[model samples]
Target: MNVATARLGARALNRALLSRQYLLRRLDLPEREVVEHLVGMHAQIPVGPYIGLWSRLAGYRPDRLSTMVTNRELVRTALMRSTIHLVTPDDCMTLRPLVQQVLDRDLYTNSSHAAVVKGLDLDEVVAAGLALLDEQPRTPADLGRALHERWPDRKPDTLAYAVRNLSALVQIPPRGTWGGTSRTIHASATTWLDRPVDPAPSVETMIRRYLAAFGPASVNDVQAWCGLTKLNEVVGRIRSSLRVYLDDNGKELFDVPEGELPDADAPAPPRYLPEFDNVLLSHANRERIIPDGLSFAEWCRRYGLMMTVRGGVLRGNLLIGGLLNGIWRIDKEKKSYTLVVEPFTKVSKKDLTALEKDGHALLEFAFPKAESRAVQVLPSR
Candidate 1:
């Protein structure tokens, strides 16, 4: 269990994340178990979660995720730093409380009027909203209008945040399931699942799970992933259960005593990560995975979307592997989706052949009507 060979390096970090995040290869574990292990899946785009899971799980049953949502085994809620996350119904019920302070801090820091809602009958509003949602899931707009009408004086945005962040809400099925295109909506966890929601699991339990999946990581990295800063106290309390290591610069990395730390020399493949992959976003010091200067959002803006020189709406496809190796796009024309790969690297004919095969396979699995793909070589600037 000792990560004795762990050196502080990017290759090591990438390989560790691959092994932990289930990205090195697909897994056959239950989807709910995978969701719990990974904390939660990024779900801004309805299909992105599916793409994320498909790339990770060997036995990816799209139907299971959908059914989990329908059955409330899995729930989507505005958790984790005010972004939507696909978490287990049980998890949403428990972790929502632990993250409340963090979510409140984010709201206060990011939004101006969070303090204004402090005096409102938060319990009553949440109760009303919960009662409304308990009967049927309602969209943000619908929930907000209802709450605002009931309160008759509160700001819609602030109320929306209160209801979403303060309550145990779940995004019901067809909103985030495969092949579904719908805006997010909220339902009470108990009502949605047809059972009472469970209580909070300790932060110690959370830290253990996080480190188990993404270990040899600093406490700060864990904080970034969980979006909290007050875990210093908890970290102090859990030292007995953790195994610690010193990085190259003599910084301590903590992990579970029973976790597997891979050899530092294991060969890593060129992994194609879906956007917002937690490995890229979950670390304060991401030098271990992405280079220091790599800003995924910036790269996406520059390469993924086409901007007008004179200023207009951005209208272009997302360019994958921007400035890293190659650029790729998903072309959805004529009711069929096709992946296009344009490698900026000097490709041997053999490499090009391999990329074409790999890219098409990726496309076909991701998009059903992906009839074919196009691969072209672009000169490196």
Candidate 2:
């Protein structure tokens, strides 16, 4: 079969990402299926995935996700870029082994971590960690303190991070629940879930999963998402089984053959994404979701400056017409609630009105207790 390298424009790529991510249209699938389909939700913050699910799935309820955690159908684990994600138990078992190298690289390469763990027996540290955690779940600091008793010379933080990096651990429940606030607690995967991890992990399978969720992407994009390097060989190994495309820069993009490819001009509804949402952070080239005129790197700079200089700076995202056009946040007062939109570019009058309507709907979904609600579109800088 000939692998034709079709060129895709910015909007074409944008629509494809939205469709793949389930942002273009809400699905009627179960919340667990939705979480599994997108690989996992970026959930360093507990409430992030709640809003993420609400934005993508119609009739999403906080209880559904919270129950998943409570019942162990889903888990909060360190995966993909070594961040906390809300992933299925199966993914937790398999994906963790696949990205073990990335976690190891992160642990060994950090100067502080390296200094403390140098010449130490990582296996013993891991064994000790599992032992301590197997006894009962403990916060990272507590784990560190317990491990420090065994290895007093090493920095406690490094010892904790070592356990985090080396072991297949899951963040225990009540920590990842909606509107829940508790100290982060962890336990070995086998102990908590009573499930064994995949003994042999495959990078090729991981690549396929990534394509299914965030596809038509280059090797760099995959690396950017998972922090794994040397994927060119992995992509090459499966190239014959994949469909290929090219970005405007002529770089090759790969996707699963059966994945949906939506029309470039398809209407994209306004979406409210929580902070550190994977749609924004998952790809090396974020142009698929970011608008045409904005520079994502520069946007990061401006966002950082504004977050420091301006109080109440919008940290989450607002997608207008399939383009990530602005930042947004909800402001609640005694009787009134406001959804503030700060656009990075000048939005058309019609789009602004649509945004207001959608923003009010989001406010209702997010904060129904308020007596009044309004969507405020701020002047663009």
Clashes of 2: 0
Candidate 2, 282: how far from true, in Å? 1.8
* Model 2 CA deviation exceeding 4 Å by range: 292-297, 303-315
Query: lDDT of candidate 1 vs native?
Result: 0.65
lDDT for 242 in candidate 2 is 96
Q: Tens digits of per-residue lDDT for model 1 on 14-38? A: 5676678775556788888888988
Model 1, C-alpha of 84: deviation from truth (Å): 1.6
Write down the TM-score of every candidate.
0.84, 0.93
For each candidate in the order shown, give its overall lDDT on alpha carbons.
0.65, 0.84
Q: Model 1, poorest ten-residue lDDT window?
A: 308-317
Q: Which stretches of candidate 1 lie over 4 Å from their true place?
A: 1-7, 59-61, 115-118, 293-295, 298-327, 342-354, 375-381
